[model samples]
Target: MTSGYLWLKAIHLVFVASWFAALFYLPRIFVNLATVPADSHAERERLLLMGRKLYRFGNLLMLIGLALGLWLWLGWGAGRFAGTGWLHAKLLLVVGAIGYQHVCRAHLRRFERLENTRTHRWFRVFNEVTVLLFAAIVILAVVKPF
Candidate 1:
C-alpha cells in the first residue's frame, strides 16, 4: 500500500513538474518574441501561433495536474498534508501558484491590445514569482517545516 501511495505521489509530482516547466518557459518565449517588430507579418504570425500554443499547453497541463493534484490530496497526499503547519504552508503556495496561472490566462487574453514589451515584462515577472512560490512549496513539502 505504501508503494502504491508512492506511485501516485510520483505521478502527481510528474504533472506538477510539467506544469512548472511550461509556466517557466511560456513567458520567456513571449519575451524573445517581443523583440520582433510587431509590424512584421511573419513575425506576428509566429508570435500569435506561439501565444495560442502557450495558451493551450499551459492551461491543459496545469488543469490535468490540478485534477491529479486534488485526487492525490484526497487519495494519497494525506501523509504530507495531514494537519501540519508545513502542509498548510505548502497548500497555500499551491493555491498561490494556481491563482497566478489564472492571472496569466487573463493577461494572455489581452495579448493583442498590449505592447509586446509590456507583455514580456508582465509574464516574465509572473514566471519568476511562480518559481519562487513553487520553491517554497517544494521546501515546505520536503522540509516539512513546523
Candidate 2:
C-alpha cells in the first residue's frame, strides 16, 4: 500500500472510532433520559445537552470518515477491492450506520422537544444495533470472505 493511502486509512480509522463511540454512547443517554422522571428536569436537561453535543461531534466524525474512505476508494486505487465483495458489504453497512446516526439525531430532537415517548427498554434495544453493525462492519473489512 502507498504511504499516502496508509495515512488516509489511518485517518479513516480514527474518525470511524470516534463516530462509533458516539453511536454507542448516545443511545445510552437516550435510555437514561427515557427513564428520568418528568420532575427530574435537571437531569433530563443534562442528558439532552450531552446528546446534542455528541450528535454534532459524531456527525463531524462521520463526515471526515466518509471523506477519507472516498479518498481511499477513488484516489488510492481501492477499486481493486471492489471485486472482492467485502468492500460492497462494508459500504452497505456504512450506509446502515449513517441511517442509524440519523435515527439518533431524530431521537435527540424528540428529547429536546420533551416529546420522547419510547421506553428505556426500547432505547436499550436500539443501542445494541450499533454494536451489532460495527462488529459486522469490522468483520467484513477484516475477513473479506468471498
Candidate 3:
C-alpha cells in the first residue's frame, strides 16, 4: 500500500473509532434519561443537551469516516477491494450503523419534546445493537470470512 493509502486508512479508522465511541455511549445516556423522575427537570434537560451535542459530533465523525473510506476504496485504491464479499458485508454493516445512529437521533428529538415512549429496558436492548454491529464489522474486516 502507498503511504498515502496508509494515511487515509489510519484517519478513517480514527474517525470510525470516535464515531463508535459516541454511538456506544449515547444510548446509555438515553437509558439514564428514561429513568429520570418526572420532576427532575434539571437532569433531564442536561441529558438532552448532552445527547444533542453528541449526536451532532457523531454525525461529523461519520461524514469524515465515510469520506476517507471512499477515498481509500475508490480514489486511492480503485479496483483493490472489488469483488470482495467481506467488503460488501462491511459496507452493509456500516450502513446499518448509520441507520442506527439516525434512530438514536430521532429518540433524542423525542426526549427533547418530552415525548419519549420507550422504556429504559427498550433502550438497553437497543444499545446492544451497536455492539453487535461493531463486532460484525470488525470480524468481517479483519477475518474476511465469507
Candidate 4:
C-alpha cells in the first residue's frame, strides 16, 4: 500500500495493457494476411512487415511488464499472496498469454513462408482467444475468487 507499490502497479498495468493491444491486433492482421490474394505479393509483404514490427514491440512490452510484476511481487512483498489459489490461477493464465503470443509468431512465420493453410475465419476465431484470456486474467487479479 506504499506509494512505490502503487507506482509500480500503475507502470506494470500500462505495459501489460500495451502488450495486450498488440496481442488483440496481431491476429486481426493475420486474418487479413490469410485473406490476401495469392498474387498480391506487395500487400502480403506489407502486412508481414507490420506484423514483425508489432511482434517485436509486443515482446519488449511483455518483458518489461513481467519484470515490473516480478518486482512488485517479490521485491515489494506482494509475495504474501503467492500461495493463494487466485494468484496461482493468474500465473497460469499469464503463461498461457505468453504461449499465445508465440503461437502468433508461428502463424506469422507460416504466412511468411506462404505455408498458411488456415482460413480467415479460423484466424478470426483465434483472435477471440486473446480476449478470453485477458478477461480471465483481469477477473482473477481483481476478483481473486478462489
**Predicted model with the maximum lDDT:** 4
Tell me the tens digit of each residue's lDDT in model 1 across 30-64.
Answer: 66566667568687667667867876787788888
Candidate 3 error regions (>4 Å): none
Q: Cα deviation in Å at residue 93, candidate 3?
A: 0.7
Worst 10 residues of 1 by lDDT: 108-117
- Give the alpha-carbon lDDT of every model: 0.73, 0.92, 0.91, 0.95
lDDT of 3 by residue, 1-146 (tens): 78887888888889998999999999999999999999999999899889989999999999999888887787886447678988888999999999999999999999998899999999999999999998998898779897
How would you order the candidates by lDDT, starting with the best? 4, 2, 3, 1
Task: Judging by lDDT, tell me the better candidate of 2 and 4.
Answer: 4
For model 2, give the 10-residue run with minimal summed lDDT.
137-146
Better of 1 and 3 by TM-score: 3
Q: Tell me the lDDT of model 1 at 50.
A: 81
Error of 2 at 117 (Å): 1.7
Candidate 1 TM-score, C-alpha based: 0.83
Q: After superposing candidate 1 on the true structure, give the runs of residues whose Cα lies further than 4 Å from its correct spot.
A: 77-80, 114-123
Give each model a TM-score: 0.83, 0.96, 0.95, 0.98
Clash pairs, candidate 3, are: none
For model 2, the stretches where C-alpha displacement exceeds 4 angstroms are none
User: For candidate 2, what is the TM-score?
Assistant: 0.96
Better of 1 and 4 by TM-score: 4
Model 3 lDDT, residue 67, Cα: 87
